[model samples]
Target chain A: MLYLVGLGLHDEKDVTVRGMEAIKGSERVYLEAYTSILGVGKERLDAFYGKDIVVADRDMVEMDSDEILRDADKVDVAFLVVGDPFGATTHADLLLRADALSIPYTVIHNASVMNAVGALGLALYNYGQTVSIPFFTDSWRPDSWLERVRENMRLGLHTLCLLDIKVKEQSEENLARGRKIYEPPRYMSVPTAISQLLSLLEDSSPSASSDSSPSLASADSLDPSTTLAISASRVGAPSQRFVAGTLAELSELDEEAFGGPLHSFVIVGRRFHALERDFAGRWAVDRERWNEVSNTVYAVRD
Target chain B: MLYLVGLGLHDEKDVTVRGMEAIKGSERVYLEAYTSILGVGKERLDAFYGKDIVVADRDMVEMDSDEILRDADKVDVAFLVVGDPFGATTHADLLLRADALSIPYTVIHNASVMNAVGALGLALYNYGQTVSIPFFTDSWRPDSWLERVRENMRLGLHTLCLLDIKVKEQSEENLARGRKIYEPPRYMSVPTAISQLLSLLEDSSPSASSDSSPSLASADSLDPSTTLAISASRVGAPSQRFVAGTLAELSELDEEAFGGPLHSFVIVGRRFHALERDFAGRWAVDRERWNEVSNTVYAVRD
Candidate 1:
């Protein structure tokens, strides 16, 4: 049997009781570490579970999954993910491999950023299609995700932007040279994401006609100063921080404002419910601006 | 301090270790019972947590919220939600109330149907705005939610339809007579939701021009026979079941196929990914039909 357990966001204690039971009963445990990371370290989890966990990097889970599933039909093997198992496609692919091997698997669901973002007081139902913001490089800057945000804004729906995390990544020099050197992990901060978004908006502006795609025609609809957004860091953790402000304001914030990694941003929709506004307003960078925008720009429903 | 802890879907064991600790340390534990429920009963939770839980119904949480927060400032008070605390707007309201009273609070996140639906293999990022399907009555048959579904389909995004759950509801007669008599709880099953959707589609068809509203002008784009959908019951529970099929076929399915309450429905959009198709294909009621629709109607991507 195979057990795909979820280590809910934050520390080792975030794991469900059922998940803990699965870990305790497993013959061997593997912790998937590439897609996302828990707030605690492997040492803490090892001490809590009383089991030595084999850290499975992206290569081990993606390229050599057969090793992870070996003998699963006979003995219980637990594969732990930082969030819900289905949060990333790679984990789903691992499950598919398990299916192909005829290994019976049980998934113990726990909270992921998808649902944990609700801690910011935005109704999950009001969110539109979630988009990912990748770390923009000077040579490989991509603004394709802007269309998703634009579509969400057009439909009066909030967009949850998941910032990129590069873990155990090989640098360009190492990849070409085949040298096994890995760069230090980098987590996209809220300020970086906001700056990237602002840059994309500027590039897609009508003034930059030479370098704009037709798909980004609707980018003009978004106004950085007037649009409300909420930047959350380390959601579901004890140190979780949320700041609601305009994109421009958030872009100007220092890294110290929202410490740590695993930050997420939400672009508020035009159709903001009164309750949602009230709940989020408590965390606003400027209460006066939040109130003014709520009354003038946003269409607050009863 | 007030602790809003989420008991993830399924039994008492679904609660996180941190949530359990909060419950154990709290002077008073109140279970938010009206919004949703777990697979196990209160007795099971009592046995597991070794604490008597006070079930907070709609009235207690809404009208009598002050009582729940009366002494919360002085001692640890835990308010348990079946899913994530922010899954519903009512919980957000409670948090706002806490903020208004200057009560310090912490939210322990857990999996809700919003993210748990990913167990069906569909990526959470592909899902659009969620809609709720209420049980249709002779006089109050609402098709307003269809527009949201249509918008999702139009954007090539899947729609997660949360089936309505009526708990501790009073009948009109009982309300008129000023009685406390409550009607039996009714949970909207997948088949019932499908039938309601089908009826709405029929009503909004071009042939029924006399009765349809102008807002439903794009209703013609939806074809029940070709549209793919997945019906899930008791998701995140051990007995959870998922069936993928056309709306018409699922509507004819027996109740026995998906047992119990807390059912959810998903309408697959035209932009179905190959991976999503493969994962959902495992539960297809008609494999041949599912394949044909995938090839002919759905624009599947790699």
Candidate 2:
């Protein structure tokens, strides 16, 4: 039997009881560690679960999945993933492979950012498609994610923007030389993402840059000086920090306020409900500034 | 301190270790009922936690929240919710109230359908705005949800249609008369939802019934004979079942195939990736028939 278990979020203790039972019942446990990271290391998990965990990187899971599924037909093998198992598409491929190999599997679900983002006080039902903002290099900058955020805003729906996390990535020279060298891990910070967004907005606004008319009308809806947003750092972690303010204010926010990796941003939509505003206001770095932006820009008079 | 803990989908064992710790530390534990239900009853959770569980229905949560928040500043009060604490907006209200009362609070996240739906092999990032389909009555049949479906389809994104569940609902007469009479719970089955969708499609088709033209251009995108769907019953449960087929075939699916309550439906979008198609095809009730429709309608001719 193949058991796909979720190690919710944060440290090792966040794993669900069912997931723990599955791990204890299994003969071998493999943890997928490339896509996301837990606050604590495998040793902490080993100490907590009282089981030896083999850390499986991207190459092992994507290339040699058969080893992970070895003898699953005869014995219980547990595959652990940070966050929910289905948060990434690679796990689905693993599940499909298990099905093809006639291995019976059980999925134990746990918390992921997809659902945990609801902590921002916005109704999940009111959220449109979520977008992922990748780190921009000198020559590579993608605006498709911005288009998605614009579409959500045009529909009066909030957009959950997932910042990128580059783990175990290789440099161009190392890749060309077929070397095993890896670059340092990079996690897109909320301030960095805001700066990218502001640059894009400025480039698109006719008054800011060259008067090349924008292709998307929705791009004009967001003015960095007026649009409100919520920047969340290390969501679902014990040391979570949230700041609510205008996009400009968020870009200039104190870098030390939000610490660590796995940051996310939410572009508040036009249909911001009063209750949502009230709830989010509690986390504002400056309540007066948040109200000033929200009142004129997001106030629902009804 | 007020602790909002999530009891993940299915049985009592689905609760996270952090949630278990909170329950153990709490002086009083209240389970929010009415929005969604756990597979096991309060007795099962009580037995697992070895603590008394107070069930908080809609009235107690919406009207008597102050009482629930009373003395939270001095005590550890655990407000348990099925799925993630923020899956429903009411819990956010409770958290806001906690803040108003100067009560420190912590949120223990768990899996909810928002993320669990990824088990169907569709990438969570590719899914657009989710829609809720309510039980249609003679006078209260609103098709606004169809607009959401159309918007997602237009964007070539999958739409997760949440079937409505009526729990402890009071009729107009009962409410107006100040009586506490409750209606029997009604969980929307997949077949019932399909029947409603088919009826709506037929009614809107120009060739069906009257000769009036359809108001929505996107209505043409969904054809009962060609559009594929996934009928999921009891998601996240041990006995969960998934059947994939065309809408026409799904409408005629056997009732016995999907037993019990809490069903959901997913309308496969036009931009079905090859991997998604292959994975979803594994669950097809009739592989040949599914292939016939999928190839002619959703074929990604790469």
Candidate 3:
């Protein structure tokens, strides 16, 4: 049997109880590393899971998935994922391979970013289209995500903007020369995403499809000074924090003590329930208005 | 402090290790029973969690939130939710309430059906609008969700059709008599959902806009079959199963065995991914023939 277990977003503890049992019961366990990540390191995961795990990088997974599944035909092998197994397409490939080989496989689900965005108090249902804001570059920067964001804003829905994370990615020279040179891994911050979004929205003004432009098409709509929430969640851990504020305010909301790798950002779009608006309020526009807005946003009947 | 933790989709083992810790540490732990439910009963959940838990129904959460938050100011309190904390807006209301009352709060994230759909090998980036299909009565059959599905299908984007679950809902008679009588909950299955979708599609043929739809017309090209995959995922535990079939074949597959509540359906209106298609090959289809069709509809590979 091949087991795909989700470790969730934070530290070792983020693994579901069943996921832990699966890990302990597996003949061999592999933790796929490239797709998503836990806030805590491997050592912490190892201690909490009570088992040693081989960290599988891109090469190990894409090239060596067969090796991982080879023994599944014999006994159980559970592969750990930082979030739910199907959270990314790579794991789905692993499942497809297992199916093709006629290996009995089971998936152990855990929390992933899809539902975790609820921490920001946006109704998951009200979220229109989710878009990814890739790391910007002088040459490869793309403005496609802007159009999706506009669609959500036009319909008064929220957009969960997943920031880009480049992990253990090899540079062109390294791959060509067969050397070990690599670019440093980077996780996109909310402020950086907001800035990129601003540039993209501004870009849409000149030669865009006239009919598709947002009614709230001004530069202010993309401004970081506008209200938004940034959740620097250490999901698998106990100290997970979801701080809300205007994009500019959260950028200044104390550089986060979230304490490890694997961070994503949520940029709030318009339209919400009074209750949802309340959750968004807790992040506070500024320290000065923190108490008042916090009350107004959260002051549902309770 | 008040902590809201998502218990994921299936059983007790679905709760994240972080969520378990919060429950273990809390002076009071309550399971919110209205929005969604775990696959098992409270006793099963308690046995798996190693603690006795109080089930908090909608009345307890919506009407008695102050009582719950009031205690949080003095001692730790943990409120459990199905899926992720914010998957339902009620938890958001609780979080904002906790924030307003100066009760420090933390949200532990989990995987809900939102991202788990990726498990079916659909590109998350390509899903457009998400619509919910609510249960209908003879007098009040609603077709609004059909419109949203059509719109999303037109855009060549996939639509995540969230099946409705009516929990602790009152009966029409109960409402009329001012009684608090409750009705049994209903969770729409994929078979049931597809029944509705096919009926709507065939019935709305004349009035339905597929070719001129924004999602469909704007796409460079799209395949009707390759464009969609319907999934019935019983996520959460190791025994979870996902069946990937076309909307047509789904109604004929084994539905009861998909097992448990919190099931969701996807209407693959339009969307394609190179890797997603590659991964989708092994799921409930003939590989030799699927490959021939896959080549035609897949996104251009990187």
Candidate 4:
């Protein structure tokens, strides 16, 4: 049996009792490390579970999954993911491989950013298609996510933007030289995500547009200064912090304002319920501004 | 301090170690009983946690919230939720009340239906706004959710329909007589939700249309016979089951096929990715029909 367990957001202790039991019964345990990171290290998890874990990077999981699933038909092989097993499509592929090999599997679910974002006081049901913001390179700036956010905004639906995390990424120079070296892991901070969003807005604004780059339609719906937004850092952790304000204000925030990495951003929709607005106001960067925009721009659905 | 801990979908063992620690340290432990239910009963949780829990029904949580928050400012109090603490808006209100009483609080996240639905091989990001399906009555047959589902289908995004669960509900006769009598709890089954959905389609169809009830726009996007759907039961439990098929076929399924209550329905959107289609095929009621619909109706985005 292949046991896919989720180490819910936070430290080693966040794993459910069932997940712990599964780990204890497993002969070999593999921790999926590329997708997301837990608050604590492998040492803490090892000490807590009394089992040594083998870290599975993207290459190993994608290319050498058979090794991970080896003898699973006869023995229990535990594969641990930072969030829920199904949070990423990559894990689904692994499950498919297990199916093809006729290896039975059990999924132990846990909280991921998809539901943990509810901690910000936004109703989960009100959220539309979630978008992911990747680390933009100088030459490879992708603004397609902006269109998704705009579509969500047009429908009066909230948008949860999952910031990118680059783990064990090979640099261009290292790849070119065929070196087996990796750059340090980089997790996008809330401020960095806001900066990228602001950059996208500027690049698509009519004032900054050239003939080569057409201006985006309905771009005004996501004005940085007026649109209400929320930034969450280290969600589901003891030190989790949520800051609500305009995108421009959030962009100006420093790491001191929101400690740690693994941040997420939410663009509040126009159809904000009165209760939602009230709950979100507790974390506002500027209380008066939050009220003004919420009252004037947003349509209260209550 | 007030601790809002999520008891992830399942039995007593599904609670995280952190949540257990909180419950152990808590002077008063309150299990939220109205929003959703765990697979196990209070006695099992009491034995596991070694603490007798005070079940907080709707009235206790809503009308008498102050009673729940009493003395939280001085001693530790844990409020347990079946899924994620923030899955329901009512919990947010409790937190707000806590804030009003100057009680600092912490949230322990866990898997909710919103994220657990991903186990059905659909990406969480692909889902749009979620809709709730209530147990329809002769006079109170609300069909506003059909429009929301239609809107999601129009945007090619999956819609997760949360079936309503009625707990401690009073019948109209009992309420009218000012009696404290309560009706037995009723949970909407998968088939009931599908039946209601099909009824909505028929009610809005041109053939069944009347002058009083106007036809819905873009109703064809959610055809019962062709549109793909997935039904999930006892999700996150060891006995969790998922069945995928057309809405019509799923509606005809009996309780034996899907063993328990607390069922959720998903209406697949047209923008189904190739990988999602392939994964969903594993649970299809009719493999040939699933493939034909995938090829003809759903736009494959690879």
lDDT of 2 by residue, A93-189 (tens): 7888998899999999999988898888888888878899989998998888998888788777788898888988999999999999999999989
Ranking by lDDT: 1, 4, 2, 3
Q: In model 1, where do residues sit more than 4 Å from their true spots?
A: A206-220, B206-220
* List of chain A TM-scores, every candidate: 0.94, 0.94, 0.83, 0.94
Model 3 misplaced regions, further than 4 Å:
A204-261, A287-302, B199-204, B207-229, B237-241, B251-262, B274-302
TM-score of each: 0.95, 0.94, 0.84, 0.95
Lowest lDDT block of 10, candidate 2 chain B: B211-220
Q: Name the Cα RMSD for model 2.
A: 3.1
Give candidate 4 misplaced runs (Cα > 4 Å).
Answer: A207-220, B207-220
Q: Interface RMSD, all models, one decimal each?
A: 1.4, 1.3, 2.3, 1.3
DockQ of each candidate, alpha-carbon based: 0.68, 0.72, 0.54, 0.67
Superpose all Cα atoms of candidate 1 onto the true structure and report the RMSD in Å to 1 decimal: 4.0
Model 1 per-residue lDDT tens digits across residues A155-217? 888999999999999999999999999999999999999888888877767564243432343
Q: Give the per-residue Cα lDDT of candidate 4 at A116.
A: 89
Error of 4 at B167 (Å): 1.0
| Preferred candidate (DockQ higher): 1 or 4 | 1
